[model samples]
Structures are given as structure tokens and as C-alpha cells.
Target: MDLFFTIVAAFTIFWFTWTYLKSKGKPPSPPGPRGLPLVGSLPFLRPDLHSYFAELASTYGPVVKLQLGSKLGILVTSPSAARQVLKDQDTVFANRDVPMTAKVLTGGRDIAWNPYGPEWRMLRKVCVIKMLSNATLDKAYALRRREVRETVGYLYNKAGSPVNVGEQMFLTILNVVTNMLWGGTVEGEARASLGAEFRQVISETTELLGMPNISDFFPALAPLDLQGAVKRMKKPMDKLNAIIESIIEQRLKKEKESGSSSAVEFKDFVQFLLQLKDEEDSKTPLTMDHIKALLLDMVVGGTDTSSNSIEFTMAEIINKPELENPLVAIPTPRLMDPTLYK
Candidate 1:
């Protein structure tokens, strides 16, 4: 019965898609696979998507058009084609078909998924001119150094125990990022627990973001959420948002108690953004939602990318000491006959 229902649904969907495409009269798309109307190429997709895509590129041209269920996928294989899409005519491809999970997390307000427009331009300006300026980063140098010292000390203390390099690096990087964003929002004993909880949430969030959601490939079925990607994402996303909200409230409370006129030192991005929110005289003023979204971007995007890079590099260095550079090596004696940063 279940199989019968699925088959009926697939046929219905194919008929609908066929009618829609026929009505549109779009130009001849790139040459590629002629998959079955019922399932398309979804069944043929291998677990290693990158290699599978490469295999397809070998058969088709650099630009391959794939019928992925209800969605049309255009795969760019060659560097020149990539350059044209990403650089030459970037505006044409600036907007992304955001997954259901990402929409839940950032509401398409964050820089990563926001479409290229005035608002996105304003966001870019805020991030670049405020958070990523040389002066801003220069101020953060002390925080990074301090976190490094603390991590090394902890490693020194736990000399005999088995240490997971990736996990430790994640915590270190996350702490540094959170401090830069909120300036000691979670303090003392709770900080350790927060790190563990945050890491677990982040790991789950990344997994959801990467997972192939039916909503992504079949927009008509998105509202149904047959896979529950959006549902699974909300808990962690909400927790992270709650944490950000608490930090914002605390900062706002401090402003109210101290009085806004009083000289409050801008030690972190939260304070800076709050101040900017009031003072911004632009046509599209920065709202609290945008501020929160950007914070989510940094926490989710920055820590994960940096930590994973460090983790992979450390693993390679530990495996073959010859690749160890003084800057990013693991320490000696602990993983003896191994190289770490000097």
C-alpha cells in the first residue's frame, strides 16, 4: 500500500512539473542526463557527491543541467565557467536557494544567505567596517593570545589523559569567538558546560545544514516538511538565539543602569552593534534582528571553519611530523615523536 501511494505521488509530481516547464518556455538548458520523470537522477546520486559530480562532468560538458526531482540543478565543473558565474556575472547568481534549516537559523537575514541588494550591501558594510577592520582585529589579538595560553595550560595539566585535538580546538576557537561577540556573556563554571552544549548544538546544526532536504529539491513539498529538517533544527537554533538574546538583554540592561550617555567602553561586537543600531542614520537602519543574525553567522560560521581547518592540519602533522609548521603544530612529548607549534 505504501509503495502504491509513493508511486502515485511520484507520477502526479512528474505530471505537474512537466506541465509547469512546458508553460514557462525557458531556453534550451545545458546538455546532461535524461533521467526518468518519476525520480530523476536522485537515485543514481552516490554518497560521495563531489566525486559523483566529477564523473558526470566527464560525461557531460563543464556545464551540466540535471533534473533533480522538481528542481533544476545547474552544475559548474570548469574553473572558467565558475569564474564567469561567480565573478563576471556574480549579480545573476548572488541569491541562493536557501535550505529550510538555514532559513530557520538566520531567517535569510545573515550575510551568508541574504540576497545581493541594498540590505545585503548594508550588512556587508557593517561587518567589514565594524567587525573585520584591522583596528577591530588588532584589539582582538589579546583575547586570542589569552585563550591560547589557557588552552596550553589545560593541555599541560592533563598531560597523561587522552586528548581529542579537534574538540579542544573547537572549544578554544568557540570561546574566543563568543568572547569577541559578547565579551564574557557566559562566565565562571557555566562557561565550560556552555562550551560542551554549544559544540554539540553546532555539530548538529552543521549536519542539518548539509543534509539533502526534500524541501530543497522539491519546493512544492517544503511546507509538508516530510523529512523534518526544519523541526530538528529549531531546538538548537532557538537555544543559540536564546543565548544571544540573553547577552543582548544583559548589554541593554547595563546600558539602562549606567545610562546611555555615560561612557561605556565597546569591548565587544554586541555593544558595538547595539550602539550602532541607535546611531545608524541610513535609509535601511540596522535592526535588532539583523544584529542577532550576524552574531549567529559568526558563531556558526567562523568557529566551525577555523576549528575544522586546525583539526585537519593537526591530524596530518601528528601523523607525519614533516608537515608540521611551527605556527600550528601540536606539542611534543604528549604525542611524542610528534610535532606541535613551538
Candidate 2:
């Protein structure tokens, strides 16, 4: 046991020292708060990471560099710097820096989180053409309009009752996303159950992504997995994957029973993925894991982002009461209210 401990200790020290020196050797990047020896600026990380980046950008010009443990991050706040990174050097910056939890939750296959490569290219192409292309998006606009109208009606009905508009908005967005992807809108008891499950998965995922993960910086410490973030993520990830699999299985069964080519017309994103899975053109046939990862990405990317933006806008409106009454009373059609539409 003593010999084993000594060997492990020596290896850990050597690995950390090597990583520190290698990172130090890189050409001088943008500057920000000087971090500690090993953990870097992890201690300063906040729930709203963007704000922290903004603060640093204000101090260190619009292009600020940050180190979180061993992970290096470049924050481009200025339009010029953003253009340089996103437009000019897009290929270099396109690759995602996948942390351990993302690898497990996404099965390392989610297009949004996947490294820039051929597989990502294929998935991106499919998403753009099949799901978000102008024609398909137009087809889905009616679904959005219906959901928005229903949500507005619900809010209008509760006008006198003190309601949590944020929660209502989140549910509204969640229902719209569910309907768009699954061909069904969650409601009442079912919505409560599904919303709980979805929230658990998304919360766990965001926590894992946003937390200052030490193992990601010092690979030697990965075995310890000190935070147990990885273990905690596994159960939620499994539950989410099972939910997606069940949905996919049900769709396939329905398609088989119908035995009609017309069923293709009713297909959603999952059906598009299933077709790609079987296509001979794919160099790597989409596996169950891949499909699940794609679904996870769609759920996370589609739902949380839209909901958060709505929440932010609503919060701003609530904070500024002077703009509220007029905005709410605008003569525009209920569904087309500029105050809420954008």
C-alpha cells in the first residue's frame, strides 16, 4: 500500500507540473484576473458566468482570457473580437470543449457538443435542412401560434389572480417545444410529471456544465471525481435517455402498425433521425446512443434557451412598471403583442 501510494503521488505531481508548464508555454493570450497555481480562476465563477466574463471584458478590453482550473476560455465581448473568432477563425474555434458529464450525457455524439468534424457536419446539415429550414419552420408556425394563443388566453383569464408569470412562461415554452418535437403537448397531470423529469435532467446538466470542475483541469484527479457530479448526473441522464427511447419506440410501433407511406408525412425530428440512421449514405449509421444524444441536445438547446430569454424579458418588464401598463394595453392583437412577441 505504501509503494502504491508513493507511485500514485509521484505520478499526480508529475502530471500537474507538466500541464502547468505546457500551458505556460502557449503564446500570451488575453489577460484577466491572475489565478492561483492549480485551480486557476475557478473560485470566482458565478451562476451567471456571462456576467463574470462581461466584467472581465470591461477591465481587460473586449477580448478577455480566463483559466478555469486547466481549461482555457476566451471571452470575446466586442463585435470586432467576436467577428474575428466567430467569423474569421470559426473553424479553429468551432470545436466544443466537452467536460466529463457532457461526454456521458450526450454519449459524446450530440451535434451541439460534439467536436467539429464530419459527424457534426452531417448532424448540423440534417438539423438545418429537415428541422429548421424555411419550409419546415413555416409548417410548424401554426403549432407555435396555437400554443402562444392558448398561453395568452390562460394569462388573460388569470389577470386578477396573482400568478407566477415566469413559471407560466416556462411551461408555455416547454409545451411548445414538446409539441414541436413529439407531436403532443403535455398538460395537467402528465405535464406535471414530464415537467418534473425534464427539470431534473436539465438542472443536473446545467449544474454540471456551469460548475467549476477540477478533474477537467487536472486529468490525474479524474479518478477521484471529488464532486461526485459525474455519479449524480448518471441517474438523471439514464431517466432522460429512457424517456426519449420510449417516445422513439412508440413512434416506430405506430409507423409499423399503420404500414403506410403517408405516415412519413406526420414525422417529427425523431423520424428524420431514424431515417438517417438507416440511410446508406451515412458513413456511420446512427446508433441508439447517437439518437438519444441528439434528442437530449434538442431538448436542452431548444427549451432552456427560449425559456430563459422569455424569463429575462419578463423580469425586465416587471422591474420597470412604467413600461408595463402601456405595453400590456397596446392595441395590437393579443397574439401579436410586441411587448411579448419578441
Candidate 3:
């Protein structure tokens, strides 16, 4: 028995060494900083990832390779390298690196995370051509106008007080989007309440989305959720799901009561989506899960982009006051109207 065990150990060592030596014939990989054994460069990562990447690019040239735990990350800094990946060979790089928390939040049904295929093509068509087309935007202009007016009124009311521009913009945009989505089905106070709830959940959801999850890097350890990012995301996901489910249920009930052909009023995005779903197009069937996922995508995606842009602009303006030296447009009392920036 001892002799057999020794032989097995010796054979394993020999096989490993042989495999390592054989791999040495291959071309060398991209240059990158050496990292630790298991965690790789994770422990050394900074909160400001962009700056860190820029620093690394200075050392490793245009393309820097990184081993993030069990995952491999290639950082392309040069414009040519970026174009190569994003434009020249877009099809090859079309798929996204979906985060574990996002999968749970979207239930693996959203366009942002769904693999590029027939389903993705369908979602893109529905979202771009059907729902958010120029004609659709024109139809929803009233909602946008109303929300902007309300925001102006809010700012006017809070005149002379220190107002949080970002927070206000986020709320206004959220209101406009929600109204465009299913505002017709959900009215006044309920709509406002729902917006508030959505704001909280969206904030939580986006923050979780940005967090680095260990499970994402190490797939084998996904079930463990060592970072607790997935666990933290569940509360927001559940709350958002409940809100959406309730709205969908109400919409369905209304449809049943009013009859299918009742053209009572203006249809929102939700109504249009449900109408498409009922058609049951075999090519790309739109399920309730898809609707919910898309809605989540809109709420989270829309608010984050707009609000963050506004906040960053505001920060730049305030932090670098010299930029407003007559050359740059300065914010003043007369410029109270947010529309002026537009």
C-alpha cells in the first residue's frame, strides 16, 4: 500500500512538471504587474480604478493583462486598441462581463446582460425602434415637459437655500421615466410613493452593481457569495419586483375589464409592451420576465447616467472655479432656470 501511494504521488509531480514545461513553447502573454497567488491584483486595487488602470498602462504600454482572482482582465488604454475592441471587432467582443449581483437583479433576462443572440436582437428592436423611437419620444414629450416644469418649480421654491442639484435631477428624471413607463396605470399619490421607493432601491441596486463580487471572479465560489454583494442586492431586487408585479397585475386587470379593443386613452410603454407580448411572436416571444427586466434596466440605467452626469458637471464647476473665468459659462442668480444649461 505504501509503495502504491508513493508511486501515485511521484506520477502526479511528473505530470505537472511536464505540462508546465510544454506550455513554455507558447508566445509570452501581455505585460502586467505580478500579483499574489490566489487573489491576484484584487487586494492592490484602488477605489479609483480608472486612475489605477491609467497608471498601469504607463508601465505596461497599451494593453495590460491582469489576473483578477480566477478571471482574466485585459486593459486597453490606447485609442487604437479601444477601437479595435469596440468597433473594428465589436461582434467578437459583444458579450458583457455580467456581474453576479446583476444576474440576480435582472434574473438574467435584461438586454444589458443577455448574451448577444436572437433574444438580444429582439430586445434591441423593441426598445429602439418600437418603444424609444423618435416618434415615441415625441408622444412622451408631455411627460418630460411636466417633470421638468415640476423640477423648475421645486428649484424656484427652494431658492436661496442650499439645494442638492443631483438629487433633485434624479427624482425628476425618475418621475418622468416612471410616467412614461406605466404612469397612466398608476396615478398621483401612488406614483409619487412608488417613485420614492424606486429611488431608494435604485440607489442600492446601482451601488451593488458597482461592487466587486468575489463570486464573479471565482465562479466555483459563486454559491458561497463570500463578499455578500448578492445577499445585499436581494432586498432591493425583491422590493423593486413587488412594485413592478403589482403594476403589471393592475394593468392586466384593467385590460380584462375594459376589454381588449378598448382604446380608452394614451398608451404608455408598458401598455405597448403588453400588447406586443400577447401577439406571441414565435421569433422572439416577449414574456412577463422580459418586461420586468427591461423596466428594471430602464429605471436603473436612466437615472444613474443622467444624475451622475449632472453631479460630475456640478462638481467640476464648483471644484475648479477658474474654469468660469468669463470664458466658461458661469452659474449665477439669473441662470436659475435649469433649461438654460440645455
Candidate 4:
């Protein structure tokens, strides 16, 4: 019975799209590679989506239009088109397309994936004022400096040995973020468990989020479980949610014991959220789910991006050995032009 229903829905969607496209007067969007009917260009998408899009742009001019399943996607490769999207029509394109994996992993509460509306606005404001504002970031700078110093010490201890720079960089960034969010460092056995959990959550989330799942574009056939990708993602999402819930419960218990008026100095993200929860905001009550989602953003956005950039910088330096020579011969800042000093 479910199969029959899925087939009927798929056919209905196809027929509706056919009629809609026929009624449109605009020339069928810019030309690009042809794809299978119903599924469209999804099959062609690669793990490295940026490179795939770049290749298509080279073949079909700067702007290439393609249909991913039933959804229309326009890839702009030209600098002018990028500027237009970023500056001229920024608000129009501000909202993101959240994939199924992201929705499940974040429990549909992350600000990055939230649709543009009141909730998004409220969350964005909270993030700016409580989390990423200059003052909050400045307060965390000492934590960052301490983490970097420890990392340098570790490298010094491993001198003359071939170091796994990737592992070291990941630990350095993770320690910094953990300190900034939890008001303490994860060390000994706790550090190992935290590192393992963090890496598993981050790695799985990125892989699932980036994968081309047909159900996202062809929503009518979602229940069919055609690709089985949705089923595959369930375990990791559950694990991530469990980790987040445990952290939240621990923080809440600690807050309760400390009492509401206690003047405990907090230099972490979780403490900041707990403080916000105490405020009288009837309009936007900070629910458990909201706290979990914010933590997800802090872990995913805060740690992964910075660590990746650090890896990239290391890789670039390795590729050009000359760049490393200046570190030994002269101070790092002296390499920069004095005229461009900010």
C-alpha cells in the first residue's frame, strides 16, 4: 500500500512539473548538462561539489542552470554574478537550503539551517549579543592564547620527530573551543572521550550534509526510501543528540546547585546561554532544544571551520618551503608590508 501511494505521488509531481514548465514563457533556464528524468542532475553531483560546479561552469559559461531531481539550482561562477548575489540581492538569497541530514542532526533548531523568519532573527540576535559579540570574543581570547601555547609546547616536545600536524591542529582547536564553551579544559580520560565524540559528530555531519540525497529534491518519493541514505544517517544523528543532551543536563544541574544570584564568573558559551535563560523574555523562551541547537552551531561552526583553515595554512606552507624559512630567520609580523598595517 505504501509503495502504491509513493508511485502515485511521484507521478503526480512529475505531471505537475511538466505542466508548470510548459506554461512558463521564459526560455528554459541556461543550458547545462542533461540528466535523467525525475532524478535530474543529482546523479552527476560529486563529493567535492565545488570542483564539480567549477567544471560545469567552464563547460557552460559562468552561469550554469541544472535540475537536481525536481528542484532548480543555478550555479554562478563569475565574479560579477557572485557580487550581485552577495551585495545587490543579499536579502533575497540569505536563506539557506537545509538538507535532510542537517535537519535531523541539528534537531531542526540550528540558526544556520533555520528558515528566515522571526525565530531566525531572534536566534541571530542571541548569537550576536551573547556569543559572538566583540566583548564575548575578547573575553575568550585568553583561552585561545593558552591553547595555542600548549600546542606549541607539545610540538617542541616532539621536535625532530615527524609530527602528525593534522592531529595536533585538531586537538589545539578542540581544546580552545571546549574551554570557551565549558569554562574548563577536557583533559586525561575526559579529553579522549570528548575528542572522540566531537570528531565522530563533526565528521559524520559533514559527510551526510554534503552527500547528494535524492529525497531532498524529490520530496514526494521520500517515504519510498529509494536511496536508503536517510536510514544510514539515523544512528549518527542519535549519537550527536545524546551527547548534546548530556552536556545540557550537566550544565542545568550545576546552575541549580549554584543558585540564581551567585556571582560566579563565566567565560564559556554554555554559561552565557544559562544566563540568557534566566532573563525575562516571554516572546522567545529558551527551550532545551534551542540550547542544544546553539551548542551544535558552536561545535560545528566554531571548531570545524577554524581547524580546516589551520590545516589549509599548514598545507600551503608545506607546499612552499620558502614560507617557513622566514619563521626561523625573522619575526612573522615583519614579513608583512608596513604600508598595509591596520
Which candidate number has the best TM-score?
1
lDDT string, candidate 1, 1-342, tens digits = 999999999988988787677858677779889886656888888899999899889999899988888787899999999999999999999988888999999998889999999999999998898788999889889888777766776686678998877677888898888888887735467767777788888889899999999888888889999999999999999899998899899989988998882386565788888887998888888999999999999998987778889888778878986676664565645533223223
Clashing pairs in 1: 329-340, 329-341, 330-340
Judged by whole-model lDDT over C-alpha atoms, candidate 1 comes out at: 0.84
Residue 152 lDDT in candidate 1: 79
Candidate 3's displacement at residue 342, Å, is: 20
Q: State TM-scores per candidate.
A: 0.86, 0.83, 0.85, 0.82
- Tell me how far the alpha carbon of residue 166 in candidate 1 is from the true structure, in angstroms, after superposition: 1.9
Residue 124, model 4: lDDT of 86
TM-score of 1: 0.86
Q: Is candidate 2 or 3 superior in TM-score?
A: 3
RMSD of 2: 5.1
Ordering by TM-score: 1, 3, 2, 4
- Which runs of model 3 end up more than 4 angstroms from their true locations? 1-28, 185-194, 261-265, 324-342
Model 3 CA RMSD to the hidden true structure, in angstroms? 4.8
In terms of lDDT, model 4 sits at 0.76
For candidate 2, report its TM-score.
0.83
Order candidates by lDDT, high to low: 1, 3, 2, 4
> Which runs in model 1 stand beyond 4 Å of their true positions?
1-25, 185-189, 318-342
The total number of steric clashes, by the backbone 3 Å criterion, in model 2 comes to 0
Q: Clashing pairs in model 4?
A: none
